[model samples]
Target: MTSSTDLRKAFAPTGKLRASINLGNPILANKNPQTGEPFGVSIDLARAFAERLGVDIELVVFDAAGKSVEAVRGEQADIGFFAIDPLRGEGIAFTSPYVLIEGSYLVPEKSPIHSNEEVDRQGIRVTVGKGSAYDLFLTRELKLAEIVRAPTSPTVVDVFVEQMLEVAAGVKQQLEADMNRFSGYRLLPGRFMVIQQAMGTPKSRGSDASTYLAKFVEEMKASGFVAEALHRHGIQGASVAPAA
Candidate 1:
């Protein structure tokens, strides 16, 4: 077993654990209305990890997943919570996912699209947050539909509505909340994808750091910590990932 001193050296070389927090994914994180500080399951996990390492924490916040991933990949932050994707894996060493979020589509209620499968046909324009996990996945998977890039994940539905796009893809909870702002939008019958949300550090952080992070995630899941965080934050449409 790696000693706490060695673990701290690997994860918090700067003497503080810098965590990249993404506010765009409401299920993982969001601002406290009263305090304007980031809060949610991811924030809870980051704080717990810092406690385990006996280090102070610094939150490096971003409004989008792409920026958060880049912070860890560039070593601007020590760790981040992100949806696992192959493109991001090039520079990030990811632990098994700690949470699983559903990716769904939102469409105007009157639209003919009734299922996740129908959105991929020709002439369909799907809007997604630029450089987001869904964007990366759809960019590779969709052969006929056109994908429009919104400036950020939280803005995806806004872009879809403004542009009169056929579909908007993102975290199911986010899409559900965005639906209330419009009179005629509804989520499709089921999810298009299951996003594996995981903790990650820069690949340059070395194997010991990666192994320790992986173990931390598995323990969190097995001990009910992940589930408790979700319930505490009032998050919906996401679940604790199975122990890995």
Candidate 2:
């Protein structure tokens, strides 16, 4: 077992804990329009973790998941919320996922593609946020369709529509919102992948920090803190990930 002193030393080297907030992931976080503060399940979990560590918390905000990952990897922040992906595991240590989000594709209403399997055709062009989990996954999984990288995750839908791409792949919630915001677009029947939304700390922080964080996540999930946060934040479509 890791003692409080050791946990603090390993995870909070600067005597303070910083959490990176990625607004790109609407399931985990949302920007408060009036306060301009991020408040959502991830924010709640970060605050609670800081309290457990008995350290002051600071939020380093970013509009993209890639930026948030970079913050933790570079030690600009001690921890960050991220989608558990092998590409990102190089510099960061991830805890078991606290939430599971589906990754789906959106296509124009009149498009020939009627399902997720139809997306990987010879001439189809798919758009995704540059450096996003879907972008990384599809980059490897797509056999024939060309991938057009948008500037950020939040802008993937816009870029997809503007560029008239055949498919737009991203968080399922984002696609649903886009369907409401725009016309003539519908999500494919099911998800292409499940995004494991997790918390990560710099690998330089050591295994103790990693272990502590993983245990904390399991506790949060078992104790209903995660479910309550989801309800409090009015989040839907994301379920607490099963024990990892």
Candidate 3:
């Protein structure tokens, strides 16, 4: 294995960094759709990367991290911000667990189910985006319950809307009604796991990239940019654990 010193030299040949962020809403990156200026938590993190690198940084925005990851994997971009998932791990290297993500089931109040555990006890179904990280996790980890996967993100939104209608019309909503009252369906407490959302070049980029970037990331962590980014975003519960 290449030593960390070697890795750092590769990542910061001139002591500068180039990174991108996902501009999707609520992602901590909200840049102009056309011009691509950095914004939000992801942008803030990028700033830290630049500051620590001691070089000018460039920022680009994408529709979402899923797309941004493509840029990183292709080497069109050096790094991108995104959520942690098994499939994404296949394509890109992540920094470390930089943030905590809390995912919960949403439904109208006064539904039959009171907690998330009750959903799997019966025949209730859950709707989620097709091929999404959440969908993958639910299918792979929560196999006890049945999930009706929507074909796309829009359809997932539609499912939520349809559920809202069901509640408005007094029918047990598919997703909008209380997870329990829709007949024992509900989201459970989000599992606590370290989702290290790290950054790396493509596996094809070779060991030099990983080795170098890894050390730079460690320095970024030690310098407190990661923690400051988390705090700036009011992410008190999330963590910035050391990846190395």
Q: How many backbone clashes does candidate 3 have?
A: 17
Error of 2 at 52 (Å): 0.2
lDDT per residue as tens, model 3, 93-191: 765555444444543445665565555534556666554445556667655556775554334535655654211111112123234334423333443
lDDT of 2 by residue, 1-244 (tens): 3488988887778888889999998988889899998899999999999999999989899999889999999999999999988989989999999999999999998998888888898999999998888988999999999999998898999999898889999999888998888899988898999999899999988887898899999999999999999989888889999987
Which number leads on TM-score?
1
What is the full ranking by lDDT, best candidate first? 1, 2, 3
- The true-versus-predicted C-alpha distance at residue 231 of model 3, in Å, is 2.3
Q: Where in model 3 is the C-alpha error above 4 Å?
A: 1-18, 25-27, 31-37, 51-56, 120-125, 129-132, 144-159, 163-194, 242-244
* lDDT values for all models: 0.93, 0.91, 0.54
TM-score of each: 0.98, 0.97, 0.66
How are the candidates ranked when ordered by TM-score, highest leading? 1, 2, 3
Comparison by TM-score, 1 against 2, better one: 1
Q: How does residue 79 of candidate 3 score in lDDT?
A: 64
